[model samples]
Target: MTSITIDLSDSQFRKLQDFARVHGIAIEVLLKASLEDWLNLQKGDFVNTADYVLMKNAELYRRLA
Candidate 1:
């Protein structure tokens, strides 16, 4: 596993800490889960966009091929 350091504003850190405490999870776990969710969302968005573009340009792509 690799570790990383990030700089957060005091308010942001406080907010995260508060949220984590309420959720009964550690800050590290909260961050990891949040990061994973965000990455998955981004991946899904990219795939959807790519599919849309490919479908929209299918005819052009076939002609070019």
Candidate 2:
């Protein structure tokens, strides 16, 4: 694995440390999990196309044409 360096505000660093302590994990593990979640979100893995179809009103569909 490659090492990376990042800068964070004092508040942000404290928050991350606190989260890692509460979860009984190292800060790097928490950071990795957060980065993974963010990357998945960026790739649109959370969107549900079927749910959108179900949520659309029939009247709206009629109006489109």
Tens digit of per-residue lDDT, candidate 2, span 40-65: 88666436655577567667878886
- What 10-residue stretch in candidate 2 is worst by lDDT? 45-54
- TM-score for every candidate vs. truth? 0.90, 0.61
Instruction: State the displacement of the C-alpha of residue 44, model 1, in Å, after optimal TM-score superposition.
Output: 0.8
Candidate 1 residue-wise lDDT, 1-65, digit = tens: 99999999999999999999999999999999999999999999999999999999999999999
RMSD of each: 1.0, 4.6
Off by over 4 Å in 2: 45-65
Question: Candidate 1: misplaced stretches above 4 Å?
Answer: none
Error of 1 at 26 (Å): 0.5
Clashes of each: 0, 0
